[model samples]
Target: MFFNTFSWKEFLLRKIISLLTVLLLVVGCENNKKSLEPITPEDFLIIAHRGASAYAPEHTIPAYEIAQQADADYIEIDLQMTKDGVLVAMHDEKVDRTTDGVGFVIEYSLEELKQLNAGRWYNSANPGLANKEFEDLKVPTLQEIFSHFGNDVNYYIEMKSPKIYKKMEEKLVSLLIQYNLIRANGELPKVIVESFNEDSLTRLHQLEPKLPLIQLFYFKEEATLSVQHYNRLSNFASGIGVNISSVDNDFIQEVQLNGFQVYLYSINNEIEMKKALNLQANGAFTNNPDMGISVRTEFEK
Candidate 1:
């Protein structure tokens, strides 16, 4: 009886050792898997909507540079075409709102647009809320912006009304390649191509399979997409960029549960910004990168 009892004790000890070995292997694998997750809150991406428009004139070189200075993770650019078929960075379909020019942006050649003062109109008395520092800014081109900023900063380029310009995607992608911004050693300037039109985004995805695309929406209520549309987008888009008003805890949770990253846009107020952070949004697009970063820092504390 004593001999049999001793053998059973030895067998139990060996089984425990084997179980521990398996546990160690699983723990190691889990640690590596967590590391491989593509996105994280620690990234805390800050996209400067329209190149820090709150502080500078929107979509101008100066405004983009200001975004960089303000430590924005990405400078959002709006793509439009000139009469000469050149791709330029300006937000409006018409230049009347942001530029001294009175007609459509497409009506003027690149040369004519260059000669116009794109900045003076937004001076302290009007659009800029009377900030004189915004004066004399010029609209930037895709080429010029790439040359100045290089691949050091992230770019969130919006295909603003691409139907008007059939070659908008081709032009932007060609420029990206010319600058060697398409693929780099590590985290090559996270270029996020966003569009309201799913068809435009689908075309871009076909062109560049690896580049991340975001579905942008400006709905007044919850996301209007049916379950079928949402499923399709989930397969195609890396994430969704929603207007701040459209995002809430329930909606954020629903998307998160579906394994989609949610990014809220143009959040300027500290209160709303804090609410977004609480929702654990992947990122926020803001016109004031300085204020955005400041609020993010506070929230972290």
Candidate 2:
């Protein structure tokens, strides 16, 4: 009886040790997998804010094409899903501001949203920059943008209102994989995912750990971030994008020191663009990619 009891204990102990060893090996394998490289100040990306929005209607194909022509590093796309579960590029949650249509983007099907003129409102608002060709410019689908540009241009895509579009992360990741934007063999993919919603970013990080992510911050009033905040963000994101007014030289230095890139948004004026360059921002989201590229050239020289 004593021998039998000892044999059972020995068997249990060996099984526990073997289980732990397997777990440790699995953990080691995971740790060995390479993480996506963080974007550094040396990158000096020129992101087109809604694709040269200063020249044409925001998120329209013409604007994106113009930005590509102007040599922007990445064309930013704000994504929202329509009623039929298709992704389209538009900044506002409702199409009223940018399109002749008046309704929530989620409320209308892609075909229904397409019926409304997207570019006429821009022409009316910016009279001096208006063009007849801008009339009846339709809202573009994400597929359309991908088809038109392919991998020739990089994309900085924002998951707008991810909470509202519950399946957006899944859908976006699927499309990226389908389009071969998620590369294998440790090469950097041209697509970057960004969002103000941390959960959305987290969901993307889980789905594709290799996909580079930028966490966006919108500041209504000026504020400074703590080291703790930067450290927490560094756990999941490769970079941060903030409203240009929210950042200073010290802020940029601190964030960069902590191994995260800083990108400032919507800098259209040359003076502001030059200031951003002086501050050594890793990138600037500009409505005029031509001006952004030119300023970067002069400043770097």
Taking all chains together, the TM-score of candidate 1 against the true structure is 0.81
Relative to the true structure, candidate 1 has a C-alpha RMSD (angstroms) of 11.6
lDDT of 2 by residue, 1-301 (tens): 9999999999999979855644554344344333655553355789999999999999999999999999998899999999899999999899889987798999999889989899998899999999998997999999899999988888999999999986899899988888887652233348888999998988889888878899899888764665456545655788788998877786676566556678898798999999898888888999999998888898889
Pairs that collide in candidate 1 are 124-130, 124-131
- Over all chains combined, what TM-score does candidate 2 have? 0.84
Q: Please, what are the lDDT tens digits per residue for candidate 1 over residues 189-299?
A: 357788887888878777776667778888788654444545566546767889878766756655655555788987888887788888888889998889889998988
Q: Model 1, which residues run further than 4 Å from truth?
A: 1-41, 126-134, 184-189
Regions of candidate 2 where Cα sits further than 4 Å from its true position: 1-34, 40-43, 184-189
Q: lDDT of each prediction vs. the true structure?
A: 0.76, 0.83
User: Cα deviation in Å at residue 185, candidate 1?
Assistant: 7.6
Residue 95's lDDT in candidate 2: 87
